[model samples]
Target: MITEQKPLHSGYGPESTAQEIVSDQDLRGKTAIVTGGHGGIGLETTRALVGAGATVIVGARSVDRAREILASLPNVEVIRLDLMDPNSVEAFAKAFMNSGRALDLLILNAGVSFPPELKDARGFDTHFATNYLGHFQLTLRLWEALKRSGNARVVALSSIGHMIGPIDFDDLHFNKRPYDKNISYGESKTACSLFAVELDRRGQEYGVRAFAVHPGAILSGLVRHLSNEDLAEWGVTRNVDGTYTSSGGFKTVEQGAATSVWCAVSPMLNGMGGVYCEDCDIAEVVSADSQLQYGVRPWAIDPTSAKKLWDISVELLNIQKDTIPNVGTNLDSDRLLNVSIEEPVVNGQLSFTR
Candidate 1:
């Protein structure tokens, strides 16, 4: 089992913001990519990272809007990337690779939630497609760049919703089971945690690491599909006072972005990977009925499950086993120039996993 320990940066809590966590840290030469960087906690994360001297690439489906929002930021660029579209994901990865820039931080922050029943071109449910598969393909496509960085870190934005249930592998796409929007969202988030654990196990020897984060509850564009009635039903908003209620412990956008920035830039987490984190710290393990305060669940941190998820993902994505690069293999400087690249294929269909 991976050790459950606190992060080295000791002073922050659930209320800390991105700026506070990154204080005094200098990312002068680092390169970062944050999906959904145009709004909400994602935007705040970009702002904080850029302010600290990192060159950030903002990925969004709408390039014009993303560019406009990031116009005044130095060393920042916006690229068109729609996680829901396989072709678009491929194009984005190709563009980044062609630039030959190594990435120091990669945050899988873009996701859709609780949408009406729909599936991608590949027939995977929409929530799973965008929230898990899209990021999965993007990470694989950029694996070479990540390995080249020599200390790259990948962060997937998971959520407390994962506590609702473990992944139902047999019916991952809700093909056989009746669909519940909340359950679908939880499954995707659970996949996020599984991905992080597996990625770390596969890449740690190459100086690359991965982490999964639950950014706490916040009102963001992620809730756009929900109406006031839906919000009330979820207890996220109240009708009497017109105020939002805590699904668990509600946080501000900045606070929600704190753990993300910390995972990206903090030297404190230097040698650690594959852990689920929250509130700017490596979360403690908590009971299922433990009020959802802070920390990871046993299922989220289970290595056996994580590896199984990886194998299942490789099979589902039709990624060849031989193509799965050996983790931690020492590479000569020259070999680093030509890292392995895998083509994403799902049963002869060119489909991108979210």
Candidate 2:
């Protein structure tokens, strides 16, 4: 059975820091991997997990920089990984698989925000390729390691931006439609959520479960693409001291990583998976017309779309995995795209999990 999309009141809130969530727990002997774990909330996540005794491997594009950033930490290893490059992703997965280690936690923590329109080597939109497809490929390639644990969790860092749009199955790469950076980013995030929904459904039977998390808005490198005008419009301001401040609703980097850590290690979520979470708890499902600042949109969690996305992703990657069956027969792209109401006009102040 799928976990209901409702909060259990897990005794954690938006202000809860990642360290606070793991203070009582010990993760000795466990092995985990965090992509882009060298900086931002990913760094805090690595710290908390390592502090709890888990050996963490931080995947980064720059091995030297990652190692330098994490040099003070023990039991943490930094390896090279570039999400835009399929070969890099494959190599990283292969190295881990070679270790014969059981992966207890796999956090899909690396992602790109709104950047200039670009494409990967395969001519796929950079946002979709990097944020969703790359992580999807990595997760599948590590299936054996995850299953070895007999109890493993995979966390996909989704965002509130998912409400901006659902997956445009026919135009994922913006081939037909003119590319709007925010929409592309939103669709990628929605894909992340759907991936978790279907992945949990398939992996739960094998002792591997998946979760999609929305780490509340923190001022991180994710906003580097936004211009000063965009920042001011979003109620953010820069002071003479060169520091930034938000009018409200922004979280500290430590607080932002709490939910991902919680979903990864919290006993409160045992036997539950496939739910989109926020503020350290499973978020409520909000109607498309609702003007809520939080909660997940229905389109992001639709099971049919999730299965269709899985099949589409496999075909795009041209990989064969006999363990999971095909479920994308005669999928109607138009219907799936139209299932959710059009996005509402809002402040566009989305909380990023990366």
Candidate maximizing lDDT = 2
TM-score of each: 0.87, 0.91
Clash pairs detected, candidate 2? none
- The per-candidate count of clashes, in order, stands at 7, 0
Q: Write the residue-wise lDDT of candidate 2 on 1-354 in tens digits.
A: 789999899889999999999999999999999998989999999999999999999888877878999999999987677777777676787788778899999999998899888887779997898889989878877777887898999999999999897899999999999999999999999999999999999888877889999998888768777778888987887656656888987999899999999999999999999999999999999997666779999999999999999999988877544433332223221222211223222222222238
What are the RMSDs of all candidates, in order? 5.1, 8.1
Tens digits of per-residue lDDT for model 1, 1-354: 353545555578889999997789899999999998778888889999999999999888767878888898898888777776666667678788888989889999888877788887768887777888878877877887899899999999998888877889899999899999989998898889989998998888888899999898887556656777888765676546554564665678999899898888888888888988888888877876666556677787778888888778667666645556557344232222122334322332121111
Worst 10 residues of 1 by lDDT: 345-354
Q: What is the lDDT of residue 226 in candidate 1?
A: 71
| lDDT at position 253, candidate 2 | 88
Question: For model 1, what is the error of residue 179's alpha carbon versus the real structure, in angstroms, after optimal superposition?
Answer: 0.4
